[model samples]
Target: MQQQTSNQATRRGPLAGVKVLEFAGIGPGPFCGMLLADMGAEVILLERAGGTFASQLFGGGRKAVANRGKQSLCIDLKHPDSKALVNRLIGQVDVLIEGYRPGVMERLGFGPADCLAVNPRLVYGRMTGWGQHGPLAQRAGHDANYAAISGALDTGRRHGGAPWAPPTLVGDMGGGGLLLAWGIACALFEAQRSGQGQVIDAAMCEGAALLAHGLFNLNAIGAWDGRCALDTSAPFYDVYPCADGEWLTVCPLEPQFYAAFVERLGLAGDPDFAGQQYDTARWPAQKARLTELFGTRERAYWLEVFADTDDCVWPVLSMDEAPQHPHNRARDSFVEVAGIVQPAPAPKLSRTPGQVQGEPPLQGEHSRAQLLALGLSPAEVDGLAAAGVIRCAG
Candidate 1:
C-alpha cells in the first residue's frame, strides 16, 4: 500500500498507508469500515452489482458518515471476470472485512482460503451473530438472539419480569464491530512478525460473553445474584428521576464516594443512613430516601447542586442532546459532514490525528476507476461492464 499525505496537519492518521477491502454489508460490517476509515485506512467497499437494500438506506448517497473515507466498486461475484478482478485487488489489500452468515462468502468464492491464496499476508475478518459453526449458526438470528444466547439479555431484566431489550449497542457495536476491528488489528500486528495471515472469527456471542466477563467473575465469587433488583449494590448504579421527571444517573461505589453522596444529598445527618451504604438490609430504605430527596429538586437544580461535588451525579442526556453537551463540545466528539451529524473519530493520537475524508460513494461509483487503477486496460474494463459483471457510477 502507498502512503498518501493529507492536506491538513491533523488529517494524516496512524493507519494512513493501510489498504482495506470491505465487503459491504449491514450493521457491524459498515461500522468496522467506518472505524478503520476514520483512522485513515484506504478502504475500498465492494458492493454487489444491483446493490443490497442496506446500501441504499445506510450508505447515504454521497453523505453517509459510516461510509465516509471509502470508495465503492460494484461487481457480480457470480461472474468469473468479477471474481478475477476481486482476486487481483485482494493481492494488494492488507485486510479484508466481511459480515456474512457462515458459508455465504465461501459460496461467493471470496472465502479466507481463496483470499489468503491471493495474498498470503491478508488479514481476513469474519463477523457474524452466532458464529461460523454451531447448531444456530445457519439459523436466522439477529443482535437480540445472539445476546440472549450469550447470557447478556438475562442480566438486563428487572427482578422476574420479561427481559428488556437493551438496544443493539451491546450486541452489534460492542460485540460485533468492535470485536472484529480488534481482531483485525491484532491479526495485522501478528502478520507483521509472522509474514503470514490468519482468519478472525468474530462472533457476537463470543464478544458479548467477553463483555460480561466482570459480571461472570462476580457471580463466581458469590458476590452477585443474576436477579437485578435483589442486588443491593445495583441500586447505586440505577438511574433515578428528578422532580421535573428528567433522569439522573448516580454511581458512587467507593465508600468515601458514598459518604460524599450522602453528605451532598443531606442524608449525612441521618443515623439510619450511616454504615448502611453496603448493607443489603438497609438498601431499600436508603434507596427510598434517596429517591424522595431526588424528587424534591428538578434535574437541572440537582445537577447544579452536584456540579462541583464528588457525588458522581450526572444528568442523563438524550442522543440529540449528547452531542451538544459542554463536555462533548469541548472534546470535539461529534462532527457534521454533508448535513449529517455523527460521532467523530475516537482514541486521539497526539501526532497522527484521524479525519472523515469524504462522503460515501453512490453504488458502483468507482468500479471503472478502481479497475483501471488496478492495471486493467480500458477494453477489458469495458468488456466486464458489457457482460454485466461490473457497473460504473455515472
Candidate 2:
C-alpha cells in the first residue's frame, strides 16, 4: 500500500486521504459533509465571509454537530477573484458537495460540469429537497415538506391524527444526507477504475420515498390500513405514559414476546387480552386497558418488571437520558468533543474505525491555515482578509 501522506496521517478512517470540498449549506447538505468527515475524509468547508445563519444560531457554532470534524474557510463566492481560487482548490479535491436550488450553483460558477472540468475525477454530490429538474425544483421547502410530498410522512401518524415525522430524520438526514454520501462513495469507487467522475442528484423528496419502500409495499398489498399493528394502533406496539408522566416503548410484535410482556403485566390470563395479535376489533379496548394499567405505575417500575425477560420493552429515554444508558456507554456510541455531546461515527469498521476528527469550527477559524495549505502565501491570504474577500479568525 502507498504510504499515508502528512495530511492523511492525522486522520484515522478508511477515507483519510480523500479530500472533500463542501460548500456549506443547511440541513441535509451539512449533514452529508459531517458523515463524510466522521468517516475520516479531510473535508474543507467553504462558507460565506460572515458565516451562515445556522452557524451562528446553533450553539454559537460549537453546538453545530453537523459541522464537526472539518476545517472552515470563509470566503465570498461572489467576489471577483473567488471563482479562480475555488477552481484551483477544486482541482486538488476528490469530491464536491453542494445543496442549493437547481440554478444556484450554476449561477455561482461551480456547478458539476464546472467543477468536473477542473478535476476530471471529481465526484459532485448535489443535495436538494425537490431535485435538479422538476416542476417543484425551484420552489422553497423544508424537511417536513419533502417527506410529506414523498408519502413517508403520511404513514407516520396514528389513525385520525395529523401525519408527522421526526424533524429531519426522514427527509434530511436519512434520505438526503445519507443517500448522497452513499452515492459519493459508490462514485468514488467507480472512479478508481473508470477514471471518471459523475454527478449525484440526490433529492430529499425522492430519498424520502425510497426510505418508505417497505411501507409502500405493505400499502400496495393492503396489509396496511392507516391504523395497522405497528402504527401506534396496536396496544402492544405503542408507547404508553406511566404514572410519573415518563414513557415506555412496548413493541412486543411477536406472539412469544407479546405473551412475555402481558405475563409480566399480570394480563396473561385476562379474557380481554387472550385473543391472538392483530385482532383490530379488540385493539382499542386492549389499548385502553394497557394505558390505564401502565399509568398506575412509574416508568422505572415497568422497566424493572420486564428487566429479565425478552418482553421487547424499554424505557422511552429522552435525549438527556440516552447518552447515559448502559448500552450506549458500553459501546461509546456518543462522544464529547469541545464540551459538546454528540453521536460518534457509526458502522464500526474492525480494521479502520471511524472517529470524530474534531469539534465544530468557527466560521473562519481555519481561513489562514487552509489558504496557506492551498498554496497561497501568507501575504496573499492576509491581503484577501484585508480586502474583505475572506474572513480570518484570530
Candidate 3:
C-alpha cells in the first residue's frame, strides 16, 4: 500500500525530529508510545506477528484509538533474522520504549546490552510493574498490585473498609506509562550533551509512591490521618448526590473558600459551623449537614448557584458530559478524530505544540514501506514476507 508518512516531518512539536521504536505491549507501553507520537515523534510500533493484541476488548485486528498517531510494522521476534532487522531499526531511532516483564527484552535480544551495542546514543526505556530489580521484580503483578504495595492504596481508605480502586489510571497509565515517557524525554535531552545512552527502570510501584510525595510529609507529622483524607469525611471536600440523581463535587479547602461556601449556604452564623472549620471534631456534623443540604437541590441548581464564583464546586461529569462542558468547550479539551471523540494532546508548547498526526494504523500497514526505506530491496522484502520473517499489509 502507498504510505502517507512522507509529510510527517511538518508537524510543529518539540519532538518533531525525534524517532521512537515502541515494542508492542498493552496499557502503559502503548499509552507512552501514543504520547511520543502525538508530540510529533515518528513512532514505529513493532507489533508481534500472529498474536492476539488484547487490552480492554481490543484484539484480533481491531486497533484502538489509544494507539493513534503511529506506524505499525509486524515482525516475528523469535525468527533467527529478526535481531538483524531490529538492530538496523535500533541504529536509526533515538528512543526505544518497551513494557515487558523485567527480563523479557533481554531474553528477546533487545536489552540494553544488545541495542546499545548497535547504537551508542540510543535511550532504552523499560516499563514494568515492580521495576528492573527488587525482591518482587519478577513477580506477577498489575496496576492495583503496584498501588497496593506502594502504600498509595493504604492512605485515604474508608473508615471501616479497605476498598480497592481499579488498576487502570494510577498505576498503568500514570506510574507505568507516563512516568516512563517522561524519563525517556529527560534521557533524550541529556543524551544530546553526553553522547551516551541510559536505561530507564520505571517501576509502577515506585512511581505510585513518588506520586504521593506530599502525602508522605502529611503522614509524617500525624496531621493527615488515613481516614481524614477521605473526601466523604470532610464537609468541604466531598461529592454529594443531587435531587436529580446526579452528582456534584465540592472542594473548598482554604478558610476563605470555606467561609464563602458557608455564607452561600446560609450557615455562616451558625454556632456549630461558625469558626471550627478545621476542627476534626466538628467535621462529622458539618458533613452530614452539607450532605442533607446539597441533596435538596438538583445538580443544575447548584451549578448555576456556584457559577461566576470560586466556590470550588462543580458537577461530577461523566465521559460524555466532560467534552461538552462549558470549561472544556472553552478550552477545547477534547477533539474528534476518525469519528471518535477523545482527549486532545496536552501541555501546549508556545512555538511547537504537539498534535494528533494521524489515525491508528492496521497491523503491518507500513511494513513494506518501512523496510524499503531501511534499504531493503523489494525482492528481499518479498522473500522475508514469504518466509514469515515479517508481516506486510496490502
Mind giving the per-residue lDDT tens digits that candidate 3 earns over 143-221?
A: 8888889887676365455746655777888878889889999999999999999999999888888887776877788
332-360: candidate 2 lDDT, tens digit per residue: 88888767677778988999988888778
The TM-score measured for candidate 1 stands at 0.92
Error of 1 at 91 (Å): 1.3
Instruction: Quote each prediction's TM-score.
Output: 0.92, 0.96, 0.94
Residue pairs in candidate 1 whose N, alpha carbon or C atoms collide under 3 angstroms: none
Regions of model 1 farther than 4 Å from truth = 1-11, 56-59, 159-161, 226-233
Whole-model lDDT values for every prediction: 0.81, 0.87, 0.82
Candidate 2 Cα lDDT to native? 0.87
Q: Which pairs clash in the backbone of model 2?
A: none
In model 2, how large is the Cα lDDT of residue 48?
92
Whose TM-score is higher: candidate 2's or candidate 3's? Answer: 2
Candidate 1 vs candidate 2: the TM-score winner is: 2
The candidate that achieves the highest TM-score relative to the unseen native structure: 2
